[model samples]
Target: MHIVIIGVGGVGGYFGGKISNSNQKVTLIARGKHLEAIQKKGLQVKSINGDFITHPFLATDRIDIVEKADLVLICTKSWQVPEAAELVKPILKEDTIVIPLQNGADNAEKVSTVLGVKHVLGGLCRIYSKIEAPGVISHFGHQPDVVFGELDKSKTNRLQKVKEVFDQAGFNNSISGDIEVDIWSKFMFITTVSGLGALTRVTIGEMYENKGTRHVLEQTATEIYKVGIAKGVSLPEDIVDRIMTFIGKQPYESTASMQRDIMEGRPSELDNFNGFIVKEGIKAEVLTPVNTFIHSCLQPMEAKARI
Candidate 1:
């Protein structure tokens, strides 16, 4: 099966590089210095497990160069989804499935609205990774797990075929019967961690170590969970406990991708993360003080980065 990965940053670079290493038909869409580096020196991934490089892999800046891929993984930031969708529309056939491995809940829906719902798949990715430098990706912690399914929770041959390819590529993948719940679960955790971490300027470990800060973190998670429940997403009852436990076990210095972006003065997914919650909360009449505060703190920073 042919696969095209749009926005070859952390999530796309790691997964695409893995598929390329397995000698699969994979093409990566990237731009700027990173694209130039991959075109010249190939894509490299540095992980705690091991490091591998894939030279001479298919890398291009033009989406038209890759057409009719069996699966197209949209790994760009949430804000970039519309532009990416418009650019890749012509490359999609009737059977082409576009999996959005992006944060926030609205990306898949937004992209699908533009490109047609039948052609879009809702997907979520779990990994601590980033483009450490040009041509290089760093996996800081956690195994890479990708979950996806049809928006309406129906199974199809296309999803199965995509699953088979991912299985062949040796990835932790799942076809969720209810991808909406899965996406919300991930959003709950991410918004809590990223909001608190970016606001505090500390890693997960440091944030959880302090009693007061840990309480604030839990409050943040509770607020997000409340918002999710109000929005009719079936979150697990013990999700807060589970998240706290996960936080205790995670790497102390680990930070959210959003937090990292904020620290580096890069455009962040704040609107998709905490800001998303705030918008939903207003609609649902759910008060989200913690998220509101985080959003307020980062708005100025994000504005500066855009300039």
Candidate 2:
């Protein structure tokens, strides 16, 4: 099968690199120094499972030439999903399967708005990684996992086909029984930590260890949980507690990708994370004080970064 990976950041790079090792053909769409480096040399992945280098059949910024993609992974930030779908639209075959593995609960919906529901799938990835250099990706923690399925939560031939490719690539993957819940579970955790991390400008450990910030953290998660429940996501009542415990177990130095992006003054998923929850809260008639505060605080930075 021919696979295309858009936005070869940490998630796309690590997964694409591993998948490229198999017999299937892989093409990576990237831009700037990263694309140049990948074309000049190859993608170097430093992973906890193992380190390896992979040369995709083609590595370029042009998606037009990557025709007949059997599968496409949109790994861009949540806000960029629509743009990605629009750009890759012409290259998609009727049977092409596209998965948005970016953070955010509505990524699949965003893609469907552009490419239609039939072409999109609900997807999310679990990994801690980043670009260490122009063409180098560092997977510092977590066994990478990709959870995906049809948007309506039904099993189909196409789902199994995608699973076979993931299996062949040798990374952990799951065809989610409840894809929406899976996406929301990840959404709640990432937004809670990322918003707090960016707001306080501290590591996860520092944020949680401080009494005042810890209270805000708990409030943030609780607000997000309330919003999720109001929005009718299948979140368990104990989700906030479990998420807090999960955050507590993270390494002191651990930080979220969104947090890193905001700290480095790059455009991030601010609108898609806390901002998304705030918007949904209003629509659901739910009160989200903590999330509103985080979104309001980051607006200045987010606006400046986008410029």
Task: Give the candidate number with the greatest lDDT.
Answer: 2
> Taking the tens digit of each residue's C-alpha lDDT, what string does model 2 give over 1-307?
9999998999999999999977679999999999999998899999989899889999988776776799999999899888998988878888999999999989998899899899888999999999999999999988899999887878899999999999999999999988988899889889989998998889998988888988888898888888877877888889888888888888898999999999999999999999998999899898888899999999999999989
lDDT of 2 at 254: 90
Error at 100, model 2, angstroms? 0.4
Clashing pairs in 2: none
Candidate 2: segments with Cα more than 4 A from true spot: none
Question: Best-fitting candidate, measured by TM-score?
Answer: 2
- In model 1, the clashing pairs are none
User: Which regions in candidate 1 have their CA more than 4 angstroms from the true location?
Assistant: none
Candidate 1, residues 99-198, lDDT tens digits: the string is: 8898887888888888999898899999889999999999878999899988888988888898887888777999999998889878877888898898
